[model samples]
Target: MRDFMDYVLTAFHHKTGWNVDNSYASLTTTANNLLDFNVPHGLSLHVSSLSSPNFATSYTLGSKGVVDGSLSFLYTSLGLNVTSRSSHIPLANLVRGYRHLQHLSLPKGKALNDVQDGGTSIAGDGRKDTLLYGRLYLPSSSLEALYLRRLSPNRLLRLNCVSDATLPSGGTVLALLQNDFGKYTTEYLYSTDSSLLGFRALYNFGYDPRYPLDQQHVSSRPARHPWDHQNGRLSAGAEAYFSPINKSGGISTGLRFTTLPIHTGFPYTMTLTLNPLMGNLSSSYAVKAGPNLSLCSRFDFNVYSYESDVSLGLELWQLSRPRVPEEVAWVKDLIRPGWEPKVAPEKVVPDEDVTGVLKARMTDKGKVGVVWECRLKELLVTLGAGLDLKKRDSVVGKFGLEVAYSS
Candidate 1:
């Protein structure tokens, strides 16, 4: 019965699809954890899906809380993606006190507009692509500015593979190793013929000196000449600026330029991002509001196309946090004694905080949307709605109910 319910819920969740930024009838939504379950067996499931009018369906799944190894798969309207991941491989585990991780992803799908004559039939066969990623940590000591270093495939640990007569299948794509200096850093990635050089400085980035999470630069050129001097994709921009301890809100900006022989449609582009967080707490309730906004501009060297959007999200965290009792009981009457407002959320997982986010979004074209999410014990519920001023847009939405018996 549990398995049957799990299947039904899985299918329903897949069919409805919700978004973390904006979900449900303006009620409750979770940020990072959309759907998560830990089974007694060695398997865990983490699923998140989103769908809107005119846009293709997308599904993403990530494994969490696993102690040792890793494996993941993702499917979309375009095609299928598979990944092999591990932290303690045979090679990396030989040395004690040294921890490392590696990941490789392969995706298969059709081209941008590979449609047939009659209609747009679903086809999953197109191009084959692969990306390899890895990171290693070394001991830190007196004479090492390169402590906890990295040697990834590319500057960003991703590469594009193409079959050709001029290039070998598996030699070396690109190699990068970064050096860290207090309040600043420098890096140099190179091969026999190609090289990339870069540098940066900051005040109080507060990054995990050992394992920095914000290492991926979306708008920066490391190699004076990109991979093989063939793919000319480079960007120059300012690094992210973080705020003080009191308020953790800041702004990031970037500019990217590409020089390719075939495409003259888009030459350069610029982006700006803002992230702000506001917190509220009382004796009985906790609320949090964090909004992320972004604006982008594209210049073809002659004409310019600009766009912008904003997502406003709020979360209701706890309801008077329950008190721990000496003896725990799974089955108890919801109403005990004097009860004006009958009952509160049950204590299924003791001391675990329950969170729900309600958010809204507005596009540059005057389309508005709202979403809500809530949690009652182990059950999750979400709903959403949308409206367009022009009355021609499709209002993609999610509304659902779920019930289960712990057998």
Candidate 2:
């Protein structure tokens, strides 16, 4: 395992002008037990200074930049079975400091029950299983970010055909099953900038939407089957800041519009904004209004409504960061003159055997869209309401609130 890891590290250094190091020897015995490794586990760390002269700060100049890659492997044997697991985390950053990051990856593997007991047949035969997981995080700032994750689990089973097999009535069976889950999210925010119109756009795509806010909810049936399904969603919106611009202690206002697309539908959309500090404080006056629309089966419907959201809160400090430098350089290099990266062309293969065909058809459709948002100091709140105008009309509403500490 150590020799294999060294080979990997050497390859990375040869391909990219970056230094690689390892701390596997420093790993404690307890950590090894956690991984169920009888032998000591290996660890490696890579570091490359951006200030190095040999390192190309920008890829646009056809320069080899700094890169970091690490991998870990472990193998263990318990009573009657052995397990193996590994993890690989790789990051590539531009030599020249850029606010954004170019590439980041986290990959993991796990294998359980490599071998099972044959003599003792319980309710079900013990099976072997393997899990693969990965996640990527890119946060440009508090207001802008992108995230992606994927997971797959595979199982192998062996079963006896009959409960009591005195005769040849029992048969042996082997089965294999696999499940997959994934998610992608991106968001951008513009904070009342005078030069550019205040705007924000948020998009979320995933195989499963049930766990919109939970990051760990990878599979759908965690308690029972513990497998997730294919689900995805995309939503985007923009807002303009207005009123009380120069005033320090008075009211403020803004305008907003957004659209959401989930499943096989046109879009559920809404537009609205509000102002709280401008009017009377004692009998606070608020205004909320927006147009709503929905489309299904190529049909479109629209509606308009008015509502208000009131809240009291405090102010806090806001921090922001720039985009990943390496990614920026990569984009620049892609547009540079005489710069080209060779990419192998894909081979076209035809399916010779005929199998069952599948088709998808859309029938009934509906949409309801309404949105309202307000923030007071440390507290933030939003409300959305819509109606599906189809053969069967339905109403939908969601409420969300958030609080943060202020300085």
Candidate 3:
């Protein structure tokens, strides 16, 4: 009986190990991508070169006759961008931080390439490697730089600086340190802009020791319990921030529950967050309705202000089939004794098998948005539109087209 119980427990751990941990701030990433991505409102163009895959440029002309453009260079470890207008901070890097730690002690020749390609192999227990990454953004002559490094398999460090000519202090700096354990993760943050200090941590209630965020251990066994395979993971996290100069502070907490799509099972993710200091509550749910369809919804309420909002969004994929000619050479041979059609075969697109995606969102405040993105052989296209239901007098709303070409 004891041997049987140990086997059952090992099977359960295998099921939970299939999923990885999520950062505390990434609880709403799925919902936000579907409902909050910006919609283009005019003509836009982007071009890139295959020989120089790391470089690209874009230009946009809005409905209000405003023109803007940007040049960007992206690589595995370095990035740079210059634009006419400033934009928000990068949420994936700054807010969400690292999802996992990587320990690499590969040979010098293949170490960099392996890391870039996400290749894993047998190595020593600890990492004898050092990695440094940097990104720079220049908007309207202002400069912002971000740098990151891994101190060890369980620790990471990051620094960010923003410089503007008009600022009284000329610039501000922010720093972050992160540590990951098998069952939980923690982060510390400090910002010179506001003299703020922050701490955040996330813990998995059903965390499996075999598969931590770093994914150092893997198994090939199947789950004995079907229910355990479907209920992937559950996690809870909290964050608090305080400013010494202002003598103020705030705290927030959140929970996330998610399932894996195993053996054609429909999977879903749900998240709830509460900010007691602000009297705010928010929740979101995203589900894969079918093979080609996804749906998501979000709700927000402010208990003190008595304000509430709700939104829904969906994504659908469409695929086009190759066309067959009605009158082929073989078919024409039957009609004429010795005649063949002079027409040549249709040129097939190399990427004809590619599928297009359409996304739409609607809010309780009478705002609706639609976006369609598709790819041709060497070109990509995006169309977007937004409508205000309350404004009946306007026959049309905002719409835009964006095109990109690559060699």
The most accurate candidate by lDDT is 3
- Write the candidate numbers in order of decreasing TM-score: 3, 1, 2
Who is ahead in lDDT, 1 or 2? 1
How many steric clashes between backbone atoms does each model show? 14, 22, 0
- Candidate 3: the clashing residue pairs are none
Lowest lDDT 10-residue stretch of candidate 3: 89-98
> What TM-scores do the predictions have?
0.27, 0.18, 0.67
- Give one digit per residue, the lDDT tens place, for model 1 in 286-343: 1111111111221111112223333332222232355543122222432456422211
Q: How accurate locally, in lDDT, is each candidate?
A: 0.25, 0.22, 0.55
Write one digit per residue (lDDT tens) for candidate 2, span 47-79: 211122111111101111333232222111211
lDDT of 2 at 239: 25
lDDT of 3 at 15: 26
How much is the lDDT of residue 74 in candidate 1? 23
Candidate 1 residue 397 Cα shift, in angstroms, is 6.7
